[model samples]
Target: MKFTTVFVALVSAVPAVFGLTINTPANVVECQPILFSWSGGQSPYYLTLVPGGQSMASPIKSFPTQTGTSYTWNVDLQANTIFNIALKDSTGSTAYSDIVTIMSGSDTSCP
Candidate 1:
């Protein structure tokens, strides 16, 4: 019983694993100032817009490096488009958010 107690205590001491995270939904409005947020990984991260079915070598757009966790980004792309945010940290760690589709006007659904 003593051996079992020691094993349990050791396992609980492990730190929680938190990978790079971005909080944007799968769909957003076009031509609006959207709030973007992320966590984990190092600072001075860069962002790129990877269009759906396109190679990562050619991003549609690229943003400046960001050090803060959250920021407001203006979306000027066309509606009914698909894309993803490729986030790369200063240490070369990279992460990609789930695929996102753009919507126009007050309508937020895809057909």
Candidate 2:
């Protein structure tokens, strides 16, 4: 009976996902257009494209104080480069999006 009770409690425990999420694809091409979207964040939010494999420092590209859930961006980095997107909410909380890699323009798989 004790084992059954413990098993039921363990099975019922589930972690909730964080509210901030990145909606863009994992791959993109340089100098091409890409769309970004997210949900579960407060307005007056901000997102920035930062260099990969580094701490949150200077952002190569930044968006204005955004109130909507989506934004279109033109990537200007070279091919084969890695990057990260930083999202900040009105309360100054920040979250990092999935690491993205920029494909070569010649790569036909990029869209």
Candidate 3:
């Protein structure tokens, strides 16, 4: 009982210990270079696109990355779809960004 409580408490603090941030558009257009940025956490980091409006148990794409603050993601998908960024480090620590919607086409520019 006591061991279980302490283990649970420590596990819950992983996110706070390795903070991460995402700088990108929540709503994005497909087939474009969507720039992504982050801060904190150990490198080399891994990123994944988890499809929204469905189960998050799996990711659509995953890759290893460096500490670079920015990355370009070429969008290419159907409209009306949503997704969010999931970042992971070598130690199995993970972080998540806010959700974004993928559209067929849009005139909006990425930041």
Candidate 4:
């Protein structure tokens, strides 16, 4: 039992030691460009945008490649739309960020 506990703890710590962070724009304006950023991972991280639980395999735009700790992409969002951002590292490990909701044009002052 003690050995199992130690193994679990070490495995869990691996991800934290590597350092990974994914973030999205605080204010996403409708019908405008929004940038998504992430950090602390390997190169060629996979980025995906899923809308309403549907796979957005083909994102409107993507970074294609990531270096260092972050990447940015511009996306056009519609009113009242919710999307999920997924990031997969080169080691086949995956992390998911928070959901992003887009407001309508009338609700936002974005051009």
Candidate 5:
């Protein structure tokens, strides 16, 4: 009886410990568009593409249909620039992905 109870308790705790995971492409071509993917979460979530600590001029994008675990965005990036992405749930819960580096142009500085 004790073993069965412990097993049930472990199974019940699994859902609470799981969270959404966001994954991006390993290598993205410079000055091109790329898609980001995620898994293990429900919908009513928002996706934002921001650089540094400032929000983009445009409004943050959202997914209306809570279907799959993946989302995609088309971003035009410049050379030697880094960007960050965030996934926010309806209840204000948020998760951040890793920094993505875009190297699309020459390294020379403008004179």
Candidate 6:
């Protein structure tokens, strides 16, 4: 009985144990389009972008959708800057992606 209970508990906790995982590049050029993807989480996710290395309280982007796992973000910010992505489910549970480095633009400087 003890073994069975333990096994069941672990099985039930799988989802919470293996929360969300975001997949994206560590470095990307500025003013380019990139796709951010995630797995192991629920649907109707919210994507928020926060500038890296800053103590900003608000996110740069608060895009919410229930369409797909990948989100296309246009990196039109500044070069050499870092950005972090946060994906949240309907329950307010969130998963964060690794910080990404933005390279210089191939054209004019970012506005």
TM-score list, all predictions:
0.73, 0.71, 0.67, 0.63, 0.61, 0.78
Q: In model 6, which regions exceed 4 Å deviation?
A: 16-18, 53-56, 109-111
- Write one digit per residue (lDDT tens) for candidate 6, span 7-57: 999999998777887786655778777788887677888888877744244
Give each prediction's root-mean-square deviation over alpha carbons.
Answer: 5.4, 6.0, 6.0, 4.3, 5.6, 2.7
Q: Rank the candidates by TM-score, best first.
A: 6, 1, 2, 3, 4, 5
Output the TM-score of candidate 4.
0.63
- Model 1: lDDT to the true structure: 0.75
Candidate 3 per-residue C-alpha lDDT over 28-108 given as tens digits, one digit per residue, 9 for 90 to 100: 777666777777777778888887644356987665576675677777556666777887766766667777887776643
How much lDDT does each candidate structure score? 0.75, 0.74, 0.71, 0.66, 0.60, 0.75
| Candidate achieving higher TM-score, 4 or 5 | 4
Residue pairs with clashing backbones, model 5: none
Quote the lDDT for 80 in model 3.
Answer: 65
Overall local distance difference test of candidate 5:
0.60
Best by TM-score: 6
Off by over 4 Å in 3: 1-18, 53-56, 106-111
Instruction: Write candidate 5's Cα lDDT for 2-67 as tens digits.
Output: 999999999998756767766756665454556777765567767775664444444233434444
The total number of steric clashes, by the backbone 3 Å criterion, in model 5 comes to 0
lDDT of candidate 3? 0.71
Instruction: Give the 10-residue window scoring lowest on summed lDDT in candidate 6.
Output: 52-61
What lDDT tens digits, residue by residue, belong to model 1 across residues 25-108? 544788777777888878998888788755365788788889998767777777877888788888777777777888786633
Clash count for each candidate, listed in order shown: 0, 0, 2, 2, 0, 0
Lowest summed lDDT window (length 10), candidate 1: 13-22
Look at candidate 6 and tell me the lDDT of residue 70.
86
